[model samples]
Target chain A: MANTTESNLPGDDVLEEPVPAMQQLLDNPFLLLFIGIAVPTVLYTIWGVMEIVNLPIAK
Target chain B: MAVNRNFRTCPTTGLVFHEPAEKLMRWNAVVAVVALLVGGVLAIGVLLTRWQAVHLLQADLFYQFLTAHGLNMLVFWIIFFEMAILYFASSTLLRCRLATPALAWAGFWLMVVGALLNNYAVLRGDSSVMFTSYAPMGAHPTFYAGLILFAVGALIACFVFFGTLVVAKAERTYHGSVPLVTFGAITAAIIAVFTIATGAIILIPTLLWSLGLIEHIDSLMYRTIWWGFGHSSQQINVAAHVSVWYAGAAVVFGAKPMSEKVSRTAFLLYIFFLQLASAHHLLADPGLTSNWKIFNTSYAMYLAVLASMVHGLTVPGSIEVAQRLKGYNNGLFEWLRRAPWGNAPFVAVFISIVGFGFLGGISGVMMGTEQLNLIIHNTLYVPGHFHATVVIGTTLAFMGLTYFLIPVLFRRKVAFGNMATWQAYIFGISMSGFSVFMMGAGTLGAPRRHWDISFAGNPFGYEFPATAWLMIALMGIFGVGALVGGAMYLAITVYSVFLGEKIQTPDFATVSAKRGMAPAPQPVAVGATGHGAGVGAWGMVAPGTFVLALVFLTSFVLYYFVNWKYLSTVWPLK
Candidate 1:
């Protein structure tokens, strides 16, 4: 109902349900939270141990 | 909610400010500024000592000040402010009561105590190990203890934020999805949890080592794990500041991101790839294979970089769309030209976006590149690049929000409007120059922490090019000027908060009425829009923004290859 000239888009006024998948992901903060925490724990932190554990002990 | 649940509606913005949450935010922000003051003082010593012209502090004291500066500015000041931002994003934006105000207060005090204790150790003439605190060069036990405590406190704050979100959801404080700004804060908090946990994992061992409980902390492992904390701290800033950008656009122009899904997808990329980009710190270190380095730096890092690039385009592009929608359609840049240039919040946010992109974004990509990072690693360029990102990008955006918060949150008319506008430009532009000049010196071979650029006392001293000295001198001047701008900002904020005229019986519409203008001219904020259904001369929603982005890309391409050319020239090929 804004007459401020910016709410002119076709879909700006009323958002359609069944939001797009990426948006659905954004909408679910918990899922994003799970993925955000999990991905790094796997690839960066746990995998990081693999990087150094295999190195030959310094003489 | 155990804490006070009183809510006061902001007359300016109409968002209800939870009383306890507002108090928490004000205190954290106040403490953050105090930390900035301490760090800024140390920066003067740092700037003078490293300038080669001044050489103010001796080597030991220089390192001490630098250590304190790094911790206070990068860790304490930033994270403390971020805690406040999280509260604002959740309890404030969602119009909900804070979940656990008691826990938040406990976290705040713990953070404060830890900060004071760390400064105590550093200034007591022992923990001059610098920000990295790499193994073998041990600091005082208190230093490690303080950092551990602070990390724990920040972790608690992050959880409180999450809990508040749950409270909002359970209570149905907001309809449909959380707003984009709140979502951005969620990203930041998620990243903060990761950063702080990573810090705890490493710093706890470091604390044990400092206390002589452990025989040795492997320097390699320590460096690797520390960067997971150190570098990802910047990732938190990236998320937070990008949110500030979106929030600013919404408040100022009623602008939404051109595509909310695209922006959120970009954040998803950050979650997946950003921390891995921390491997750039380990690139030059021995024992890491070329394969890991190449994959992490070139491939994974670029994806993270892509996320930032997506934000860079959308933030301004959305603003352009909003302006065009308001009928600023005379030319490609009339919208930009006729933007709310006089408003402090608008100027600060706009300048932050452009400076972060052109200065911070482009340079960051070049420095993150596997091959090119070697050229600038361990040089002044590291600090210079971060100055752009953290100071220009993050701090400026925070300042912009502060300007906005003054009128709305504090319920005071911001004092010295004209001076505030100039303060934005002064701080942004001067800091940009200071960073670039430091990078110029770094490119000419200035070492990172060395007190003297000339290496006057060393017997086997190698002389840098003449241009290096010039670069250092220029940076010093610009750095000092930037400090003055920072001082101005502090003065303005302090005065406005305490002494500015109060708004009683607040009618937000009265300002436009007083100005005798049509209501349409005033930027009455609607929520961020996702759909763009119009056309411009360039057959796009935001042609002017596209032009600006093309300029950014062109600069990035040119600078990137130029670094490559510089590297090729210096390569010791057989």
Candidate 2:
């Protein structure tokens, strides 16, 4: 691999620069994981369960 | 290299592989192909019986083997290979050691055992309840147990993948971002975690019911929960295979994604909305509210479809741009024409992108539509749609990646030099034909999962249209060809793994350095503070790809309404 340390030398402010807001959210695997799990759970599983439970008794 | 710290650097691609992770990947892939071998054998019986002239298997054997075929191909084979992809994407792509290699091996063994037990349960004759072991029709407890074990193992593996990513970051493996391919793999792993959890949610209780510990389980509940596992399993495949498409482009043409932001957002859309496509199976089912149905099938599903469309365009678009940069920019399709037609990995992935987009994507959108689904919900068309998506989309892409992996990871030259390329085209073409004919037979009312569509020996005979019969026969013929193609893939893969000559360093270049280099993104704007923003296209880089996407959109629009037109021909609603 090319010398990454050369680019990451002490004076380079690139390491300290702020990650863009969208990049921050997208790059965090845990946050994305939470969103991925929670959204699907709410939209599909929980909502489907609610609909199923509310069904009137078939006479 | 020692066992604990062993890492091998590929001279060609310059990617480093952790030894344990590589071993795990190799074993997982080998197991996946073994599962494919089992599934392919069952496919022959299934196809022959459907052919009607041969009608090889009896009804009992047919259902049993069909169950095995579905489980092996859909669940076992696909998941095992995905586990391999996860390891590679995380540990190899990110240039880090695999975290907790022992835990990964445990997961692998559990998966292997679970697959064996599941197949055993299905083939035992008593547990022939088919892939959707719907409630009120109980199988042996072991069938549910095996699947649960498999899902648990898969969940464990997903965590291992996530852990590897964490290790990579802490270790500072790559500079700016993990490559786009790794991001896509993470998307797949996230979906996988959700899928396995859904499987456990439904299957555990069903296992109890099968053991007679519970009195009853609701059929409706069973179905709703199962499709969450069932169809969302395909969602994982979508994410994984799409990653392969991106990686294939990079490997074959040194292509970079046009915009990392656009591609990543498309993956983000999948995370939020893709599982709602589980509702595609439920659109025809009773008791589900129309409002609920419409929301899932319409708005939510469209977002997911949009995500797939974006990927479908960008993978090829990126390829076209790379080719154009290589100076093939005469006309719109000159870039495509000048592509490496005889290369196995290139041919396979290109066919996958086109076939999946044209055949699978359009059909999927139509099926997911609430009204259009009514026409072909539980028919041969259902399998036809998935064969395009799952077989052509996922399986073929995986095969392409395998050709690349054989030389790089396995360090073996591909065994069937020219023959492997033929295998890819043959598989792509035959399977495309099979899917179309199957859907045609389905339009004329051929039921899926029926051992005999002819309705032989029934007192009240129900004969389908003659064209349906021809359609089915043609489907069978094409299906047979696909199976032969599948066999060729197996032979080529197995021979290469065990017997093909070893490759010395630099013998095969996965990503050629000097040739096919993607040009740097051009400046989109100049900031006030001397900072400049760059983007993929300085001007128009991929006009050919734009035309192709327009073609796709046109076909999709036509197909969407054609289904609506077909639905209108049904008995008019009052």
Q: What is the DockQ of each candidate?
A: 0.24, 0.42
Model 1 off-target regions past 4 Å?
A1-21, B1-3, B506-532
Per-prediction backbone clash count: 0, 0
Alpha-carbon local distance difference test for all models: 0.83, 0.86
DockQ of candidate 2 is 0.42
Give the Cα error of residue B543 in candidate 1, in Å.
Answer: 0.6
- Per-residue CA lDDT of model 2 for B151-207, tens digit only, reads 988999999999998887765666667789999999999999999999999999999
CAPRI tier for the interface of model 1: acceptable
DockQ of 1: 0.24
Interface RMSD of every predicted model, in angstroms: 8.2, 6.9
* Tens-place lDDT digits, model 1, residues A1-59: 11122223234468667766766777777787788878777777677667887899979
lDDT of 2: 0.86
The collision pairs in model 1 are none
Model 2: which docking level applies? Answer: acceptable
The 10-residue segment of model 2 chain B with minimum total lDDT is B512-521
